[model samples]
Target: MTWSIVARDPETGHLGIAVASRFFAVGAIVPSMRGGIGAIATQAFISPLYGTDGLMLLADGQSPESIIATLTDRDDGCQQRQMHLIDGQGRNAAFTGQKCIDWAGHIIDDDVSVAGNMLVGPNVIAETLRVYKETEGTPLPERLLAAMDAGEAAGGDKRGRQSAALKICRDQDYPWLDIRADDHPDPLGELRRLYAVAQERFLHVVETMPTRANPHGLTDRRLIDEKIAALEAARIADGRPSPSFATPLKPA
Candidate 1:
């Protein structure tokens, strides 16, 4: 019913998860992450506890493999669930319950894990991992989207697509970017559009928000405006279009 990719970006140490499913608001339950800790995607008899408690275990410095073992060892319904994770140390692991629907399984690699249940076939996760590895230097968010797109092309959820989500956490407890299309005709496509819309102004503001290093984030409106203008100017000078939700804004 769902497939997800959880990864730690080697370039920036950011943690991210992207998920899609033939279920309503899959984002709400399938994906969870804490900046600087790790990420988890729980589906197929989804358990929100796996996400919340799993992060606690990650914060405790437990290995991804250990965490999965501990969690499943305690859950009586473990055989009906599926999950995957990537810890802060870049170790990754995943589990597919024996009782999960056919076509259920996962792939784990250094700093990344892809898992799914009720998917079309093995190529779904295979293509996902392939695209993610191929786009090495791309930003984590874009890379995630591209990987999921490839999986969808390879045959995503055997049932159909209903919702999708993309979440990225750089170095804070909260997410740097989190977007969801709870229910849509083309959830993955909607996610891409939402991400593009985020680039327009939302992400610029996110950069100025409070973080651990700077408890008092950039609060001066004038300086914030200047910083955004500078970035936009640089983009234009490089022949890139301005970021905008509807139309690209012309450089002033």
Candidate 2:
């Protein structure tokens, strides 16, 4: 029914998850991460708590192996669930239930983990991990998306695509990027498009967003506008199609 990747950017400590599934709105349910903590993907039986509580456990200094065991120990449905995590220390672990559908399993690589159930075959997760490894120099978000694209090319959910998602968090408590194709014939592609569009304008605006490091953020309108324009120009110079971002709302 689902497969996912949870990873930490070695260069940035940024955490992210990318997932795709035959189920609708899988994004809203599967991925959870906290900056300076770790990430979790809970699918198969889909207990949302594995995501929420799992973060607390990780923050409490629990290892990925201990976190998984604690979560399954409390859930009666563990036999049908699949879960995986990578903690702040780079410790990673994964679980695929005995009752999971065929072709279900997970792989742990340094700084990343890949897991899935009800997929076309083991090649799906394998190729996903392979791509993530091959793209080590790419940004975490793009690397995750690339891995998912490879998984889809290798034949993703046997039943076909429905929803997909990408999430990324830096030092901020909130996500740096959270995009979803909740219900689409080609959800992964849609997520990728949304990511590209974000770079065109939204990501620049985000730079001005108030954060722990920039409590006041950027109040200079000219500076913000210049940054955004520069980003748009860079996109065009790369021979990429430009985005149709709306005019920014006038500050009230």
Candidate 3:
């Protein structure tokens, strides 16, 4: 019911997962990652616990293969499960249950795993890997989203696509950028648009940091006070009252 790629961007040390499915809200189920930890995709029988458990195992310093083996060993329904994992070191691994529906399988590469069950064909996974590798020069999330789009174009879920998602995390301690498109007519497309919006927001946050820095060594304290006053006025005009300070000018 799902097709997904779990991967590490070797150049950025960023971990990400992209998934699309005939299932509703696939994002809520398949993709998972933690900053500086690992990424995992669990589908088919779709054990959600594996996401948390796998990250914990990686955090405990387990290797990717060992973590996957332990996870598979503990699950009684392993044969019906599909999973792809990547550790912090960019090591990758994947598993597809022999009992999965027709056209089910996975492909593993140096830092990525692409897998799908009940797909239109094995080419879904193949095309996903090809796109990921070919788009290596792009940002991790954009490349992952492109891979999902390519898989969908190659014929994704046999039942047809309903939802898609992209999750990525960095070692820097801001919130992970997790975006989803559920119950959309073209969920993967919507997910791509949302990812673009997220990129803009990330840039806005990054730009705000520089504004806080004192770019000039000017000792005129009054200039700082005047700039603060102008900023407060602008915020008030924008219909957002300042939480910290009162309006510089009193109400008439």
Model 1 Cα lDDT, one tens digit per residue, 81-145? 99999987788889999999979999988789899999999999999999999999988999999
Cα lDDT tens digits, model 3, 1-252, are: 999998887877888888999988999989778867888899998988778798899889898789779998998998899888998898878888888898899999998999999999999999999999999888888888889889999999999878888887776423257878889889988886776555433433432332214444355556555665676577768997433322355667
Q: lDDT per residue, candidate 2, 1-252, as tens digits?
A: 999999998888999999999999999999999888999999998899999999998989989998899999987889899999998778899999999997899999999999999999999999999999999998888899999999999999999999999999887888889999999999998998899888776777877888988898888879988877787678768887654456755978
lDDT of each: 0.92, 0.91, 0.81
C-alpha TM-scores of all predictions = 0.91, 0.92, 0.80
- Superior candidate under lDDT, 1 versus 2: 1
**Model 3, runs deviating above 4 Å:** 172-175, 206-252
Order the candidates by TM-score, highest first. 2, 1, 3
CA shift of 17, model 2, Å: 0.4
Kindly indicate the candidate among 1 and 2 with the higher TM-score: 2
Q: Worst 10-residue stretch by lDDT in candidate 2?
A: 240-249
Ranking by lDDT: 1, 2, 3
- Best of the candidates, TM-score: 2
Question: In candidate 3, where is summed lDDT lowest over 10 consecutive residues?
Answer: 203-212
Stretches of candidate 2 off by over 4 Å are 233-252
- Give all candidate RMSDs, comma-separated: 3.2, 2.4, 7.9
